[model samples]
Structures are given as C-alpha cells and as structure tokens.
Target: MPLIYQLLLGLVLTLLIPLWPSNTLPFLHLLRSLTTTPMMDGISLAQKAQLHEVADLMLEIYKTLAAMRYIDAQAINPGPHNVSDLLYGLDPAVIYLYSILPYIDKDFATNTAFFNGGIFADFRKSDDVEQGRDPFYGSPSEENFEDEDGPYMRPWVTPLSLLGNHGSAIVYDTRQHHIWIIDQEGWSSTDPALEGVEDGEPDSINRNYFAHIANRPAGDVLRDMVRWYRELKELPGGTEYSDLCWDHWDMDLKSLFEKNGWPDNFDGDAFLVDQAREFCALRAKGDAENPLGEVKKFTDWKNGKADRAKKAQEALDAAQNLNETWKARFELWNAERSVLRNTEELKKAQQEADRLCPNGVCQRPEDLPLWELVAVQRELGWKQNDLSYHRDWAEKSKESDPEEAKTYRAAFYLAEKEVATYEKAYEAAKADADRLCPGRSPKSVAGIKDLDQDDTMRDVQRRTELDVILTRELDALREWAAQIPPEANEAKGMADNQIEGLDKSVEDNQAALKKAQDWIAEEKEKE
Candidate 1:
C-alpha cells in the first residue's frame, strides 16, 4: 500500500476504535504507541527528528480523540451519507475529516474526499455506492420513500450535484443535540417564508434550528465555532489553533491544499484598515480647506453687506429729498392761504360798501367817472370866482365829515387790497396748480362777471382745492419718509446679522481645523 493509504487507514482506525477501559491504561498506552508511531523516511537525523515531532503531535491528537465520545454512524439521522449522495455518493466522513484535520497536522497533504476540481479518494472507491439512490435508506427507486421537505430538498445543498464539488463542512455535536453547518457564507436552515414568524406552532423550525457561521471580510465567526469545538473536545494541554485561525481558513490553509487556495472574493483586513485611514486623511484634508471655504463665504457676505449699506444710504437720501420738497410745498401753501385770507377781507369790505350804499352813487375812486366828481362840486354851490375858496372850504368840510370820509377811505382801501390780494393769490395758485396738474391752467377770479358773488366764491374754492392737493402730497411724502427708516434699519440689521453669523461660522470652522491639525500631528507622531 502507498504511504498515503497507510496514513488514511491509521486515521480511520483511530476514529472507529473506542478507548480501552480506565483500568487498562498501561495496555492502552502501549497499543497507542505501536499504532500511532511515526513512519520514518530514509532521511538525515535532523529530518528524522522533525518527522518524529510531527508524529508526536499526531499522537497527541489521537489521545485527545480517545477521550471524546464517539458519534456512531447510526446516531446521525438524515446523516452524512444522505448528504453525500448529492455529491455522487462520496463518503461524507472523509470530507469532514479532511476539512478539519489539516489544521492540526499541517504536514498531512492528502485529501480523502472531493475538493476543488478533483477527487482524492485513493484509499476507498465510491463506485460501489449506487448513484441516484435514496441516501437515507439503501432502497430501490420504486420504493418512493423520499421526503420532499427532507435535507435533500434544501437549496444550499445544490453544489453537491457537481462532479468535483466542494461545499460546507457539516459537524454533528452529540453533546448539544444539534448539527452545526459551518459555511464561509452563512446558511439559513429555516424556510424563507417562515422568517420572523414567531407566532407559529410549537414544533415549528425557526432560526433556533439553524446556526450560521458567516465569515465577513472584517472578521470570521467560523473561528468562534472552531473555538467552541475545541472547548468541547478539551484536548490535552489546552491546545489552541493558531492566531490566524480567526482569519478565513481558506486564506490560512492556502499552502496546504494542491488546488484549494484563498477565496477570490477575500479582501484582507489590512485593505479595509488602509481604506479607513485614507478616509480619515481625506476628512483631515477637508478640514484643512475649511478656512479657505469660509473666506470665500465671508467675502460674499461682505459684498452683500456693502450693497445693503449702499442701498440704505440711498434710501435715506431719497427720504431727505422728499422731506425738503414737502417743506417747500408747505411754505407755498401757507403763503397762498395768507393771500386767500387777505382777499376774503377785501371781499367782505366790498359787501359792506354795498350795504352802506343801496344806490349806485357810492362808487370806489377807481370806479368813479370824472364828470361825476365835477357834478358833485357844482352841487356844493360855489361860483367860479370863489371856486378856489370854495374848494378849500369843501376839502375842509370833507375832512370834518367823519362818516363820509370814513366810507370814502374804506372803499379806496378795499379796491387796492383786492387788486394786490388777487395778484398774489393768482400767482401763487397758478404756480402750485401748474406743478400739481402740469398742463392744466388755473381759472382766473377776474374773468367772473358777478364780482361780489362769483369772484369771491371762485377764489375761495380754488384756495380750498389747492390746499387739498398740497395736503395730500405732503401726507404722501411723510408716509414715504416714515416707511424708509424702518426699511433702512431692517437692511442694516440683516447685514449685521449676516456678518455676525459668518464670523461665528468662520470661528467654528477654524476651531475644527485646529482640532483636525492637532489630531493629524498626533497621528504622525505615533507613526
């Protein structure tokens, strides 16, 4: 037989044989020494020593196995054979043992099961096992005893149909009464429909029946499962798997198998750590650029603030000019009112003259004809020779007559006052009315035929109308000025608030940048 076959035979015998009774320690020890002895190659002493050490380690594993309770082939229901039938009738125990034993005896090179793209079944032939037969029971095809919901129907086992299939290792833990299906990608035994279904029948199989061992890029849970197995086995001297056991076994066992190597999808933890470091460096770079970003933002805010200030000043100047215009209008209005008042007095005097003289004889000096004055002198009965003397006497008498002289002087004064008042009022009203109405001309009081009633009333109405217009314009100007102050204040306030907020933001960013710098410096020092 080949040396590899001898090794395989030895391993099978070790698993099958029960430990000797506790009383037969010496005999058991001798039997183990003879059977578990290393096969020495025809090499130098140093090479021989190394082989012996490896042999000794294998012996230790055997001793640990001796203490463990053997799980007989019969105890495994829906067992390995049933699973292996899907692998074209390969022995499941060979696959299980070949998967785990290499971790202990690193020099063990032969795999006694299907792995990668080849089968290493030299010691035992699978040709005798019936193909496409029910693996649970060695029954004929016509029996129809296969269950639809059994392990054979599971989707995870589909890989077993391939000729050179490599799949997950299944281990039955007799102590826990549960089977642990260890796969790199986690497995779910519960039907997908029954997921998160808590309120089901008492016997319903949920996540409780399944144990998934996911090996993520960052960490592998299979390592924990291996540790749990080791604890259960309780190997002598508390032997531990290597530090790299936590890493993916496919990666850890790269050198051991001929075709099996690290998984193609594996991205090592170092790559992730480097990626995280790069991310941190990028964040630090972003922090370093914060000041410049803030500078640009502050520049925009400054420009906006300047624009708002300029707008506020313009608003204030517009308000001031409006106020000046209103003041000039008000002064003009006041002067017009004064002229109207004087014109009203002149009108009242004319009415008084009409009351004092019902007849048309009491005419004003400007209204009297030259013949009327001479007739009045002739009625005073003075001869031509004594005309001068009489005229002097008549003038003295007139001065002496208080009522006549008072009436004469009042009428003359009234006519002169009316002329002056009308001229002043007309000029003022025309200027103001022209400004207000632009193309329209003011109506003249002199054009009215009824001097006492029509002219007086027209003059009063025009004054009132002009007063209304000036008052309304003044009110609008006041309203505009009133609105500007609040708007200017609001603009100023907004600019101030913007600058203040920008300052605060810049300060905050600077502080963050400082902290980032400190952190970067600290990280550098550590490096």
Candidate 2:
C-alpha cells in the first residue's frame, strides 16, 4: 500500500512540474507590457475593413470615370467642334452621374447636399466674393428664396424640392447596395411649424420632403458628381483621405466627411432628371412635342441609354471588385505591420530587462548597487551556463570524485537567484529609459536638446547606474569564471577558448558603450 502511494505521488509531481509557472521578473517588465500591450492589441479590425471598403470604392469610381470618358469619346468623335445626338443624350447623364459620383457610398458626404453647394459654402466661409461682388450674390436672400433664375435654377446644383425650392439628399447604402435619395424642403420652402402645422401632414418636414430625381440626363448633376467622385478618389480612402475622421483629434463624424470633400447630404439625384420642370416649362411655351411622337422618341432614347448603362454598370462592377481586392491587401499590410511592431516592442522590453540585470541575484546588495543589469545579465546568464558546464565537468570528473558532481547542484541554485537579481534590475532600467526617452534610444541620440532639463537628468541617472553596475558586474563575472576549474585537459582547453572569446566580446561591447557615453556628454555640453 505504501509503495503504491509513493508511485502515485511521483506521478502527480511529474505532471505538476511541467505546469510550474516561471518566477516573476521585476515590476518594470510588467508595467511596460501593460502599457504597451493595449496599444498593440487595440488595432481595430473595423479599421482594416474600412480601409478595404475605401479602396474598393475608389476603384469602383475609377471604373465609372473610365466608362464616362468612353461615352464622352464617342460623343466627340471627328474633331472637337460639334455636338452629336449622343452628346445630347449623354450630357444629362454625365452631369447628373458625375455630380453624385464623388459622394456615393462614402461616409463623408451628406446624403442631402450637392458637392458644388459644399464648395460654395466653403467659399462663403472664407469670405470669398466673385469680382468684388457681395459674397451672397446669386445666392438666396432671406426675403427672396429663389436664386437669380428662380426655383427652377438654383445657385447650387441641387434639384428643386417638390414642396419648396430645397436641395434633396442622396446616399448609397453599401449594405443594401442601393442608392437612397432624400427630399429636403429647399430654403425657399416655408417651414410648416412657422405656418402652425405639425408632424405627419403630407407636406410635413417628416415626410420624404426632398424630391427624388433620376440619373437620366446627367448634365449639371453628372458633372458635379464626377468632379466630386474624382476628388474623393484622391483621398486616403479616396487616394489621400486620412484614416482620422476630421484628422486625428477631430471627433465630429460629419465634419470629417465634409473635410474629405464629401457632401454632408447628397442630392445629386434630384437634379439628375429635371424632366418634369423642363416639360412643364416647355409645355407652357407651347413647344411641347406631340404625345405619341414624344413617346416613340423617348423609347428609342431610353433603349440606347439602357444599353450604354448596362455596359457602364458591368465596368463599374469589375472596378468595384478590383478596388475591394486592393483594400483587402492594404488591410493585410496594416495588420502585418501592427503585429510586427507589437512583437518588436515585446522583444525590446525583454532585451532591456536583460541589459539592466547581468546577474539574476536580485536580493544581493552588490547586484542592487551596480545596476548595470545589461552588462551583468550576461554574467548572470553565465552562472547558469557555467553551472551547466561544471555539472558536465563534474560528471566526467566523477571518475576522480563523485562528490564534485554534487557541488554544482547548490551553486546552480545560487546562480538562479543571481540571475533573477540581474533580470529585475535590467527590467527596471529598461522601464526608466523608456519613460525618459520615450521613442528615442540612448544610443541613437545625436543631440541633447533637453540634456540639462530635469527630465533628461532622470534618464541620465538611470543610464549612469546601469553603466556602474556593468563595470562591477563584469569584475565579479571574471572572478567567477576563474573559479571554474578544469576537469580534464580537453575540458580545460574548451573553457579557455570560451573564456577568451567571451573576454574579447566584453571588451568590444565596452568600447561601443563608451561611444554612447561620449554622445551623452556631447549633448550635455551643447545644452
């Protein structure tokens, strides 16, 4: 029964040993890891997704632009002086499509405003006036809401509101993959509340107050849409549009959109097809076409337009797909960069800790005083190495004295403590350096702009402590190395070779460190 119990205990011990936790390092390592880990890990997956979306959208716009150019080329064949039948048909589409293209499927543009109107707004904000005229020239006045040409023609390129002379809003719902047009009561429209009306009235503001126009006759609407679309393409999400909404510190989503040259509310569709307005005016002039003839002509025009549109749509789809591909690649690149930075940071923290503490003896008074954790860390590391070497030596030496093998067992434990001390000191020094220098490393500092400042002094002191510790730690390491006796002629030869190489490396490292010190001094002098 006792034998069985012992066997069970041994099995438990063996299993638990593999699961044993590592001894804790200094508080600094923990602190640095805590502070930096979140930043590294905080990268939003949504950001990658957004980048891909932007790239996709840009490519899509590029394709659409290409198609428009193709259509334009067809319209202007045989030199550049005459308009073709195609020109008349394509003009309205171009004007309308291009006007809204810049703002489509973008988070930046307003769903109900025109891009030109936005530009005009900005021009007004800068107090710009055309030819020394009032800044509001041609714009709607408080008393006269109509533009110079009346409600049919707006100072801005938006469509006439059915209820009033207001701009309509347009947006592309990427999720639903459909265009959404919103009606807004134009500035000319009187407010219902002011007229003592409430919600839910047919003409209430809550209704789809903005008119929905078509992308048929592109003319002004197409031109504006194309211009804005091209402009957006230049943004980072566009071609240069920055990831920061309004820029890094801006919190307003709408402002960010506007800054990127997108409409706060797009209404390109309202102006795209002003057929009713045109027809009404033409009918009033008694020049309207016979209904039967007009219908036949309209069918022919519509069929031709549909054929071209189908082609344009196919090109747009291909472009959109390409854009998505590019975006995906960009996201992957960003993700990789982020991961690499995080890994490098982690490695840097570990290296810094090792540098501060050469020997692992955290509790030793000498280890505490030296603080040259980096220089001493190798020495501390050697304790383990030397102990291992000694154990191997002792194993072979067992032919001479079996007890020699046992001697390293205790020293191995001492070596572990010594290594721990060095580790802690190294970690602390690294943390201090990081705090003092932020991103600038001591070795990389070419000048000391703030050398004499209190902040600089704190870092300098930490560095100085590290240097002093390094000096003393090396001396102790030499003493320890000397004590490692040769077990055999072969062992002695190997130890001698290793010690010689280590000594040379140490000297070279010290010389390089001295250069770093000189740089610090130079910076101080300049200060």
Q: Per-residue lDDT tens digits of candidate 1, residues 1-527?
A: 35565467667656645664667765444444434555333333233232233323323333322222111111112211222233543333333322222121111211122211212221112431232122222223232224323333121111221122323333232112223333323332222222343432323223222323221211122233233333432111111121111123223222211122212333333222222222223333333334444445544554555455555445545555544434333333334443454455445544543543334233233322222222222222222324344334445557689655544443343333323433343344335445554553212211112323333345545555555544544444344334334335543344345445545555554555556556656767999
The C-alpha stretches of model 2 lying farther than 4 A from their native spots are 1-460, 483-509
lDDT tens per residue, model 2, 235-316:
2121112221112222333333344334434332221112112222223222112323333444455455545555544544
RMSD of each: 51.1, 40.6
RMSD of 2: 40.6
| Candidate 1 error regions (>4 Å) | 1-172, 176-178, 182-207, 211-509, 516-527
List the global CA lDDT of all models. 0.33, 0.34
- On lDDT, the candidate that comes out on top is 2
- Looking at candidate 1, the ten consecutive residues that score lowest on lDDT are 235-244
User: Compared to the true structure, candidate 1 yields what TM-score?
Assistant: 0.15
